[model samples]
Target: INTGAIKSEAASSMEMTELQNTESGEIISGNLHILANSTIDNKGLVNVNQLFIDAETLNNQPDARIYADNATLNTSTLNNNAILAARNNVSISTETLFNNKNAEIVSQGNLQIAGVSIGGALTSAHQVINSGGRIEASGDIAINTDELQNLNAGITTQWVTDSIERIIEVQPEGWAHKYDVSRFPLIHNHNVEGQPFTDENGNIIRYFEDYTYYDYTAKTQSTHIISSAPAKIIAAGNIELKGNVLNSDSQIVAGQKLNISGGSLQNSATPGQKRVSYNGTRQFRDWDGNDEELDFGGIAPYSPAPKNTEFNLGVSLFEDSHADIKSLANIQTMTLPVVNSAMFSLVAKPTKFYIETDPQFLDYRDWLSSDYMLQKLAFDPANTMKRLGDGY
Candidate 1:
């Protein structure tokens, strides 16, 4: 258990790695491997060339930082509060993971997280998985969980737009003074019917005449470029939620396809309420304005029931993934307000599919017309060919 500050010179490299710090610790190593039961408390820094931490539970506190060329953290529980960055790949496997308070786990290469519950802000040059934390990747993003709650975060893999330019010279009239005259051998040899140029004496000259033009105009050769790679976000689970706000922070934007296989997707401000109906004769509706009444038509009615008898059913009003109700009925639906631009897919098998959008629904047309979204969103097709800055 290291409590005091451990310092190493820039040239130094420690080989061993087993950290159980109570408060603070720092390791500067070439290659390190942290065994089980290791914890990095506040202000801890693990900077190494390669790091592999196979611990029971690895908790990186708010001020902690871990930097490496490549890292692999295999733990039962991983609670990171600060940053875990790597130049190459960063693979983290855990049963339970919590990346709280805007914590970041970034990788310049690929990143993979296999866990039961995942919550964090993850950014990678390749692949990643995240919850109500911002997930940005250049490649694919695959997340398989039991339940996902992205209250106020986004998953985006925007297009990669870049441009190049070259300078072109424009001449008004005559050829330049430095023009090569060797090609016109007839003018120099005086063997053709008409000489290239006449001398001052109005006689054909053996030598070619110089144009003597030095001034030339220069113009920019601009090429507008628009390209995008295949970026997909596949979120498969029982339930998923990507906030109800209309801001950019809650959007799920993919360059290519956004495939979501979930039992329910609640995207509205108001939760989808469920209604209870006793028998086929009597009907009880959801108290909320938009109630999805459940039909118990096939099932038998309550036996020996009083006038106001209420049988306790093991189901919550907002729990859409009720095992009993889900098996009996079809509740696989998506409540998405804004769907625009890219290709979108929702997989709720063996049920009549439907999408419930907000009253004030917005699509690509609205997104392109909005001043705020125009300035904020990436790769607007309307301005794809328009020259705005130094490069398009």
Candidate 2:
């Protein structure tokens, strides 16, 4: 179908095997029902009161649109590079769904997506870009998938805010146009006869049917996404995000409780390299009974010597790697064996309170006693022991 329009009444629904619209072709139906074995491609306007689609593959080109009051899709694969806007809800159930950069899936009420994966293809290593997928709704958004491996996507349930005041274009008479004033209320001043401005001879001089509306200029292009509605993302298996070193590059926020539960989530694609280095000064008493400052030589010298002419050191140590001593400085520190043994017993005994939720996971006691876990806790920068003692 090309360069024309197909109109239907509200009582009947149209069914098709394959729909290819181009050259500004238009389809206006009460309800559109499409069932294609391979693909249902659209490159023009598709306006329906309601839409239902079941196909193996579907694609909406960059210049195309599929607008409806409500839309429901069941397909194996979908590559939506254009717009899929619904007034009420947009529900999709597929094996794989990839919404490309600049693509949109907008709903005024609810948006739900259930699939194996979203955005990029599943892989072991994280992908390249930080952002690509776009999914937004004014109500709630729910996604249930095994892997949500997007390239730093931001899934939001926020209302869109226009950044600039756009010129309103009014279509001519005899054109089949859907009135958008129902969605956006208009503010205008009219005369006593319930009309707009009038001429000197008492003749009504009206502008376009729906007068021009004004949109205030905004400071930023981004939407006011800070106060959003409730959203849920349940990755039943695992989730992988790429190029998310910065927090703002990728986020999933809810207005109330943002519930996100998955088996695991990761951002780094490569294994981290382990390295540790230290530089400072140490004070000690030499064999000749003379107090001397031994320079370890990284940042500055140690001050206020400890007992027996030894200095107490507070160092930020990194485990899994040996400490690199830059200078040949003799290092010594007093150790309390009794305190160390007592602390370990208390920290390890409390592990029995945690039940083993999965057989694959080690028992709480065994995991807490592991060499890696112990070393990590001891050198944690956030002071894990302090938080634990506070019952956090």
Candidate 3:
């Protein structure tokens, strides 16, 4: 039948067209074959067992969806900005399949299509597309479109029809969702439906890559960037870092040179690894108010050393990654704080010494004895002493 809208009706024997939204309607079951062009402008879900569409053109809306077990379309053009699913296989032999503008697909079997501008994505056990097809995708993509390899993948949609005609080419043995600009080619596909990632086994996820030259003027003051994975910047040209660039695994690789004429590439500043512990350095207020009689009357310990003397100094300092920084500009020679920011916690105590008073020269008891020369009377009647500088 050739019509715009189609609703199935009961039939005696029809297996492929048992379609129904809710069970409230009549048990209509029939098969239909479209011979001319058709457009499904629906917003609800459509489920069918098998469908054979030989229409000249198929135009689907934004929220429309057509699901079937196996679908074949020999149309001239298939502009699908909606969803199309098939449980078995989907073969489109159209001249051009503009699966752009939010078009999505799911194939439980295999999918083969020939097109020029392929902006949408398909999930199948196996997907094969003809050459000269530009595809933007993530997750595992087994593609053989090497004819359009010379196209430069710009970082936007402008790369789609750039006269050279850029196509989102997936690397061999690489998932479309795992493109690392530093290690692999830049993922210049934008607005692809397989992005905003998901963990579904049959989904094509999206990844990110940094641009070569990012600019910042007075108008662009504060900016915050958040990513699901580590951020990387790989440039064949120059880069100017102006503000604070923070990342868990932030890396910047330049092929030839980089021009950082202004702003610094300094990391977060933290205090050095240093600590001090006072040993036997506590001071008391002479609680009993008797300094000379404390040794005899009280049981407290006393030292003959003066108050200005140092008792002990326990300093614990060690070298860190910052100390190993040989040069600030020569990033290759020295270690980077980004790689070695984690410090090891350890304590190295200082050596403490105990002075002995048992020797004759150091004995305070001998010096304080009454027989010593210091204990002799200063002015005596029978004292015999020479004047100063005359005799000792």
Candidate 4:
């Protein structure tokens, strides 16, 4: 279809196959299921209630969009790089999802993207929960997961391994002189152990060397995440996160080994109370700031006023009225639905919890520095037992 909309209504299921291209308009329905060897390149919009795709190959371009409240996809390959992107809610599963490194998954509710490989980023109003695979949120991220190794949801953040490593780099002789090594002439070289330098008279010289080292220590970002509602992601196997795991709150029970590396683990939450607006009798304030109920008030205002009186339309029965004409009391009110909000929670456990830094990554930072350089490794969460090269 070049333009306009297409609605398919069949009893069992509807299928759109052998289609290579599609343009404008939107296809909105209750549920959706896409098959392989088909292309749905809608320029306008493509909205569905529950969306599923089992295509061998799927391509989502700069202008394409596939929106749904819940999505479950199993594609061998996918390309989603839309400028506006798709607004997908609920949990999403993929076999091998490839998103634009720049494009992000936009959602207002809980999101779980578990796949063999994921390339894009995720932006949510609720949380990025873990069901399987590995995930990491860069900064200001909210974490909510399903299960833990040998444990259930709502377990405290546990550290399995914490240690430090030294990164050694060998440079040419003139390299030290060019950068001026006066500030840090020598350091305790972890690699070159017990090798001593000698003077012309065979007298022993200083044993320390000139290479730089990094301490891979464990540091907590935030304590724990707190939220009103709870969420969980249960998986059958181990859940490992090679990147950062940032969350606002949760409780967890670990079942297997949970591993992370080359990333940070964070849990944060901002808690506050909301003041309720009361609809009652108005009070008159005196010049001194003291206030009292007006004398005209018969009794205190009883029921709450409708935020909107008309929309609150409903039938009501009246009780016995006052027999005498002088009696008063005749006012109707209704309480409509209000107080809707979004909440998030997270929990994860593994047989072990690990967040270790990669010493090889030290070259990315201050490699040009000289004379007792500080090799600072990027904050990376660990997922396994780590040992210094020589220690093991």
Please name the candidate that would achieve the greatest TM-score relative to the true structure. 2
The candidate 3 region of ten consecutive residues with least summed lDDT is 153-162
Which tens-of-lDDT digit does each residue in 4-64 have in candidate 3?
Answer: 3445743233223222222122221233354443442334444445565655456655555
TM-score of each: 0.37, 0.41, 0.28, 0.30
Off by more than 4 A, model 2: 115-131, 152-248, 267-392
Comparing 3 with 4 on lDDT, the higher-scoring candidate is: 4
Clashes in each model (backbone N, CA, C under 3 Å)?
0, 1, 6, 42
lDDT of each: 0.42, 0.46, 0.32, 0.34
Expressed as tens digits, the lDDT of each residue in 121-215 for candidate 2 is 32221221213545656677665555554443432322333333322222213324423323221222222233444333455544333222222
Highest-scoring model, lDDT: 2
**CA shift of 346, model 1, Å:** 42
Global CA lDDT computed for model 1: 0.42
Q: For model 2, give the 10-residue run with minimal summed lDDT.
A: 312-321
Quote the lDDT for 167 in model 1. 20
Clashing pairs in 1: none
